[model samples]
Target: MLTPYLAMFLDGRGLNSVEIGQLLALITLTRILGPNLWANLADRSGKSLRILQIGAALALASFFVIFIADGFWGLTLCFGLIMMFWTAIMPQMEVITLNSVAGDAHKYSRIRLWGSLGFILLTISAGRLIDWFGTEVLLVICLALLAALLLVSTRLREPEQLPDNSPHTGSIWSKLKSPVFLGFILALCLLQVGFGPYNSFFTLFMKDLGYSGMQTGLLLSLGVLAEILIFLKAGRLIQRFGIKWMLLISLALTVVRWALLAHFAHLPWVLIATQCIHAASFGLTHATAIQFIHRYFGRRYQSRGQALYVSLAGGLGGAVGNFGAGLLWQQGQGATQAFLAAAMVVGVSLVVILLIPSRHLECASEPAR
Candidate 1:
């Protein structure tokens, strides 16, 4: 509800397109710092659950100010503070989920698919609610959900032991300097950068094309439906084809998906087709990234690894994507150019990933390096 509806809400509040993008960028920008800060604290204290609880509470509190936040700076402060805490919440959640699955990357999908279910439910319902009540309904729904998250976080606990027992004795700096790590980070960041326009403006763009809120919601949920199917078989797909090939498939399809959107979004069927490939663009990409992190960062540094991935890829990449999309959009006049550039960026990611050296793969089929 929050992410899909944020730009619309801010737009309803009278913000311009670029300003909306800037605010979204600012939110992601906090992830770059917030995750690292909270991860270090959790690593030292062994209180991942506590930290998440605290962050959720704080984020909930900060977001309430959105109700009254006026003007650019005011909205900036509100979203900035919320995202700072939000960054902490998500990385902790990922760490916990990964630990619970005990390194079975495929099984992680079983647990994660529920999130897609909820997203579908909320997105469709919110669309109907918005159709009846207006985007202002978003504020109330968002607050309710955040409050529920705080309530849920209280009941969460750490796993009895982390998944990996191998001692993580190497310096983080040394690990960070590896060619594979560098390549992975760079490619993933660029892939996310390629997601900028869709993430920030897809809904508004659809609205401009004369689609109703309910139609837009259905289209967004259609993507998540594809996401759910992919998550179900993600582990098998990765195992059969290998992470290297799977990533290649996902990135290549992402290139196609965005290009189609660039040229054909005005046609409803094209939008539907692009939505269908979200499984590759997001669900598969995310599952593989988690697999890579789980392998690269050992138990001791798992939280930090998660934080770093979230910060660099989701944070830095997302910031560039949002800000760049806003500029390319030029208040809806250049939607095609914005999406076209996104396709090109992902194409670059495809090239870089292909050059990432397919050695050290765990199996003949899968690249589990």
Candidate 2:
């Protein structure tokens, strides 16, 4: 909801493209630091729900300050503060969801799919609303959503724990030192780098191509709608194909998706068709990555694993991608070149993933249900 219109809102508020990119980068940058910090507190205290509630409260307060924010620095400060708390929510939620489902990793998708539905509803409606009411309405909608989050956070029960028998790991740092784990993290980072241009500039790109706000929202919703369908079937797909194969397929589709968008933005059908790839690029890949983190890091370090994923891929990778895309887009090379650059980055990630032995990429065995 807020995503599709955030860049536009900043633009409407008089920030130039570079400034908008910088502001977006700040949000991602905080993800790098914020999640791990909060996760450490949650894991140590066994108080994830409490932490979530506090973060939501702080986020709502910080975001409200955006109403008064003007110029780059003012908006940057407020958005950064908001993200400091907001980024903590997802990693904790991932841990909570995984814990609740116990050993049935497949069920994770069904629980998470509702989030995709929410995203679709908000994004599509926000687009139409923004078109009708102006981008300033974004702040109000965001405030309402945040307030709802705070209220909901208070009701979330502690996750039920599964019985554990696996040997305790030495430390997260020791596990991080392994070649396979390092390779996986690096590959994930590159994948997010590939996503940078699309995340930050796609809406603006569509508008420049003369698409209306409703069309922009519909296009975005189309991708998530595809994502929802994938989530509905993701459990079965993972069981059959394995995580490694599914990840490879996703990377391949992402490559094609970006290329098509770069070269054929003029064709509405091409754009619409390309949106379907979101099922592969985001839906499958994200679900698989969460499963991988659960298996790879084990239960003791689950929160840290998720935090690392968010910090590296979403945080560092996204910041770099948005910053680079903004600079490139401003260089007169146009959106095509930025997306082409993204494709090239993903190509590098493909090579990295290919280097990992197939055995290391195999899905972990399920625990007893």
Candidate 3:
């Protein structure tokens, strides 16, 4: 929703591309610290739902400050605070949902598709609203959405886990050290690093290439639409191909997709074609990795499991990519250069995945129950 308007927003506030990238990097950096801490808190207290609710409430409140903040630094302060609270929801929520489904954790895909659907609907609607009313409407609308999320939070019950039968107190460190799991995270970070330029600047890039606002929205929504479909079938795919293979393939495709983006920005069909890869690049990789966490980590450590995944890959790796891309972007280098660098990141990630042993994958055969 904020994608198209970000360049304009930052430009209006006197930030160049590099400064905008730096701030975006910082926003994601919060997840590196915030999510792991919150997940650990939830682990000790068995209050994942409560933590989620509190984060929602805080997110709703922070937007009030965001709407009123002036200048880059003020907005940065507001964004930092808001992200610190907002980043905790997904990791723990994944743990909750995995626990909820129990033996049929493969059904996670069907459940997660809703988020992609929400993004598709909101992205299109937000574009139309911004075009009709102007970009300033963004904060007000986001505030309204957060208010609704606060209400939504109240209705969600904390997920229940199967009672622990083992005598040994399990540590998250042991669960995380499985080389396959670490390799998976490294691969995803590279894949997402490739996506950094696309996420932060795609709308502006399309506009520069002469696409209309509505067209930009359609293109963005198209990728999410593909994601929705892929997510619906993720469980089956994970069963058929296994997580390690899935990660490797997805990262490989990410390299190709970003290379295409770098080389073919002006070709309409190429733009559309590149987005089809969302299925593998994001949907498959995300679903597979989360499933691995569920398989490797028991219910007691699930929140921390998800948090580790989000923090290292989506948070820190993504921040590095976004910031680096921003520097390249501000140098007056073309979009192609940013995407090419992303492709390189993914390539390195692909090499890292080769070192992961497949024996750790035996757990995928066991149901979450």
User: RMSD, each candidate, Å?
Assistant: 2.0, 1.6, 2.2
Candidates, ranked, TM-score = 2, 1, 3
lDDT of 2 by residue, 1-369 (tens): 576677788888988778877888887899999999998888888777788888888988888788888998998888888889987788888888888887355789988889988988888888888889989999999999999999988888998666655443578898788777788888889999998888888888888888888889889989999998998888888878787788888888888888988898789898988899999989998988888887777777788888989998989998998888877776334788888999989888888888888776763434322
Error in Å for residue 289 of model 3 = 1.1
Let me know the TM-score candidate 1 reaches against the reference structure: 0.96
In order, the Cα lDDT scores of the candidates are 0.87, 0.83, 0.78
Among these predictions, the greatest lDDT belongs to: 1
Q: Estimate, for each residue in 46-122, the C-alpha lDDT of model 1 and write its tens digit.
A: 78888899998998988789888898889888888988998888888887887787778778998899999999999
Q: Cα lDDT of model 3 overall?
A: 0.78
Model 1 residue 36 CA deviation (Å) reads: 0.6
**Given candidate 2, what's the lDDT at residue 292?**
80
Tens digits of per-residue lDDT, candidate 3, 237-339, equal 7788777688788888888999998998778899998888978888888888787766666667777878887888888887888788888886345588888
Q: Give model 2's TM-score versus the native structure.
A: 0.96
Q: lDDT winner between 1 and 3, please give it.
A: 1
